[model samples]
Target: MRTFLDSFFILCLCFTTARSLECTRCTDYSGEGCSQTTSACPANTNTCVFTYSELRIANQVVPLTTKTCGNDNECNQISRMTLAEDTSFLRSSTCCNSDNCTSPTPILPVLDTTPNGFSCPACYLINSTSCQSTGTIACRGDETRCIRMSINGGATFSLAFQGCSSANICSMQQYFNGLNSQLNYGVACCDPSSQGSNTCTV
Candidate 1:
């Protein structure tokens, strides 16, 4: 009877050892010993274990992907309105054939100086066509002129201050400055009784 009990105990030990061999170790994915509380099994014998430092180094070696302007309005914000070669006009739905589409905005010359001091709208210009001026035009004596595309979709003309010496002879010059910088688009016509020549006020 003692011999039978000893054999039974040996059989139970063998079963426990077989189960431990199936899972091995939980650390370094060590392939030895029974880890009762872990869900992980021993890693493949041929593969190296990934350390925390190794994971961090591998992460540093790669870049993560990101998104920009994923939606429609955001998409429109970065879109460029090609002028001249593509000659696009920023038209609101009220001015467009499609009632749902907003018009493309115009591309203007960027200036080193912004039009401040006076209550002027923000100017839009690309890096290549930025203006190189530093002076401001007063309402009467000083005048500043710059060429712009036509508002009527024809010629790239000059939109400048006519020097308010007198109110009668205040017609601003519209020129063809060989740069092909003309305003050939449409905007609301400023009433003659309003300020400026109302030439290219888009």
Candidate 2:
């Protein structure tokens, strides 16, 4: 009976395996062969997105690009927000939706380095009672809000980030909260009119 059931399941699986969409997927440095190849997209995902990011540390920045399949709503939004004053953030993204339709190395939006006259305390502290504000950073582009994020890794690890954020991120706040594997996150955003007084504090 067990052998017969296994065979039946295999037949069913084979019959239903080809229904999902196909998309090009890879993550590589810009100009270093980013578009690798195509693959079957996961269930319910219908759009492919090409994301370019500038990851900034204390004094260094690295550019990265990735192609992946996701929802249609994610395609329309392009935003830049600084986590802990440029610790790590998805600087920009462009998307397309079609059968096997990821473009060849989409261009990243130029970062608006011109400060728009916004400031927030910045810190990227790992495992501490509180993350003190290192200093204030000038916000650029649509980064008009101050953001504070706390991530609890597990029993022994905790991460904290606070800095300037884009208004689009405030509108789509739910997406960022779900990233932690441990499912522990706390995020708060405040507008420019508030003087960012309380939002920047740990």
Candidate 3:
């Protein structure tokens, strides 16, 4: 009986060790290398994921990249959509499942700053009753609507982003999940009568 119990314990330990996966976690956008220590994934975590996004707000454009644990569904899922002249667009996600199987950082393409004449109310403020902006920006391409995205995940931690949006983003039908949070997005498209009105106040 003692021998059998010891064998059972050893088997369980071996199983757990076999399931452990190590993945690199890091974030960078300025063409810098993202190097970090490997982390042991939780037992339930399935895959390691890397994502890159380019966001254009007002006159400023920025990039965001991250590495995190993701599900099997996100594996090899590459999604990219430009919001009217690429105002703010989600780039892609590359997911791998093997231990320490993370790929290299993605290289971002060059920026296209050409104005597409799509304009909307653009403000990214927090806990404020109104959006404050001196002027509206030109929408690039296929982005003909004003959009507002509100994220509420943590208690008292809410963010608001109101800007130009493409039809692809405004009529988005799916809600995607990210590290520790599920993004619930809502969009209000600019009516034809509201275009170039400085504010989609309708």
TM-score top scorer: 2
Model 3 residue runs over 4 Å out of place are: 1-22, 28-31, 37-47, 53-64, 71-93, 128-136, 141-145, 153-156, 166-178, 181-202
lDDT of 3 by residue, 1-202 (tens): 2221121111001012334677767665553445576677656668776766555546764555666655566544433333333345545567778877866555555544455565665665544323565556566544556666554433434445566655544543232322323333334556443553534631
Alpha-carbon RMSD of each model: 33.1, 10.8, 13.1
Model 2 clash pairs are none
Measured on C-alpha atoms, candidate 3 has an lDDT of 0.50
Candidate order by decreasing lDDT: 2, 3, 1
Better of 1 and 3 by lDDT: 3
CA displacement after TM-score superposition, residue 171 of candidate 2 (Å):
4.3
Query: How high is the CA lDDT of each candidate model?
Result: 0.19, 0.58, 0.50
Higher-lDDT candidate among 1 and 2? 2
The candidate maximizing lDDT is 2
lDDT for residue 24 in candidate 2, whole number 0-100: 69
Query: Model 2 Cα displacement at 89 (Å)?
Result: 4.7
User: For candidate 2, what is the lDDT?
Assistant: 0.58
